[model samples]
Target: MGYLLAVAAAVLFGANGSVTKIMMEAGLSPAQVTQFRLLGTAIVAGLVLVVVDRAAFRLPRRQWPVMIVLGIVGVAVLQATYAAAVQRLPVGIALLLEYTAVLMVALVAFFFFKEQVKTRLWVAIALVLVGLAVVARVWSSELDALGVVLAIGAAVCLAAYFLIGERQVAKTSALAVSFWTMTIATVFWSFVSGWWELDASVFTQPVDIGGVGGELVVPMLLPLLWNVVLGTFAPFLLSLAALRFLPATAAGIVASSEVIFAFAVAWLWLGETLDVVQIVGAAVVLAGVILAQTARAGKVVDADLALTTGPITTVRDTAVP
Candidate 1:
């Protein structure tokens, strides 16, 4: 059940990359799409808290600063950068860039936080760097430079989410952390999202759901709703529920399948196909990510892995690429 749940979450998250691209192509700016996602997630999480744990709605004063940081940086900036990257780069490549957060977390834990990481971490780092080089085809410089930068920025935000949430997850419920952080993200993005300028007719307009040369069409609201419900909130719950039955390391390892799913879905749905060399590079990077999932020896490694594994986890996990 745990494995199934984790894979289900990964499937949703992976496919979400395509859906996000669809929304962006339908006339929404990355900031507007991000604002909508954050706002929708906050509402869903808040509603869940109302039913199961109303106390979560009232956080202590001391935690406000951390929650604010998590909301603005972790959720807001992470989602915005990711959305922008998706618009400018292939979905799989964008996700691969953001997933480097796992590598960043492990290295930070080892060098700065003084956590005991396995020696395998060094091997994982080398693999990731080499794999990314191959995937990016840095020699030819074929990938978009600005898109790569945005994706890397998303990785940095994701790393902050993991490091900060590692401590808070011990004291707070994951759902509560999600609710507060997303709420903060929604609030932060509201100022910059220019959401008011958005016309309601935009959602009612039919848009091409297919990417590149495809022809399938749908109401823009359909994918937009899916982005909020199935893409973000549903999978988030699935990942948290999976944690009840699987160790964080195991769950994290399983969640790494999101990258593969992203690649497959993008190829099939968006016509974003990578060549044989890039596929091999992706495989190598995934192997390193799996290794990184288990490289930490500290007890908190479980929390760390849980939050950093899947794409679009919450504060205790992601709102990543």
Candidate 2:
């Protein structure tokens, strides 16, 4: 059930790229879409929390600082940057770059946090870097430089999202954490996106509902609602539910499958297909991601053991004492 939930979440997240791109092509800026998506999701999640767990509304004052940072940097920045990258780059390529957050988290743990990690992490990092080069086809100069940069920025923010979220969840329910995070993100984006400047009638406008070559058309509000409901809220809740039964390591690896799903969905829906070499590169990068997930699991176990057992000591002067 946990595995199924995780895969379901990945499917939703993977499908979101094409949906977002469709909206972008129909006359919405990435920022506007992001603002609406966050605000809608926050409202829905907040309502759910009110009915299901009213106590979640009572957040501790101490959590405000980190939660604010998570809202601004992790949620708002990450989503906007990813949306921008998707608009500029192929959805699959943008997602591939953003998923490098797993690698980023491993490196940060080792260096900044001074955590003990297995040597395999370095090998994993190397594999991902090589795979990225192959995917980018560096010699061909086909990829957009700005898109790649934004994707990398998204990766950094994603790493921070997971790190901060792990801490936040330790002290609160995942539902509560998600609600507050989305609320904060909504507020932040509302100010930055200048959402008030958007015309209200735009939501009722007929827009293209598919990719560049697509023929389907729908009201703009439909896909926007889908973005909020299926793309963000539903998948997020599923992911949190999956963590209840799956180990973090297993869940992380399963979650990484979002890249494959994204590529597949884009290929089918948007007619964006990668070359054989890029496909192989994506596979290699996923392999490295799995390896890094294992290393992270080991690091967590090591930390737990150290905390529980303490440092080893010898009884050298216990003869007469």
Clashing pairs in 2: none
Determine which window of 10 residues in candidate 2 has minimal summed lDDT: 304-313
Q: Which pairs of residues have clashing backbones in candidate 1? A: 312-318, 313-318, 313-319, 314-318
Where does model 2 exceed 4 Å of error?
212-214, 298-321
lDDT of 1 by residue, 1-321 (tens): 888988988888899989999888788999998988888878888888899999998899988998888888888898899999999999999988888888888889889989888888889998999999999999999999999999999989888887887776458877788888888888999999999998888778898886766788888888888998988888878877787777667777777888889999998888899999999999999888878867877332332223222223323232222
TM-score of each: 0.93, 0.89
- Residue 50 shift from truth in candidate 1, angstroms: 0.9
Candidate 2 residue 216 C-alpha distance from true site, Å? 1.2
What is the per-residue lDDT of model 2 for residues 16-105, given as tens digits with 9 covering 90 to 100? 888999898888899998888878877887899889999989988988998888778877888899899999998988987877776777
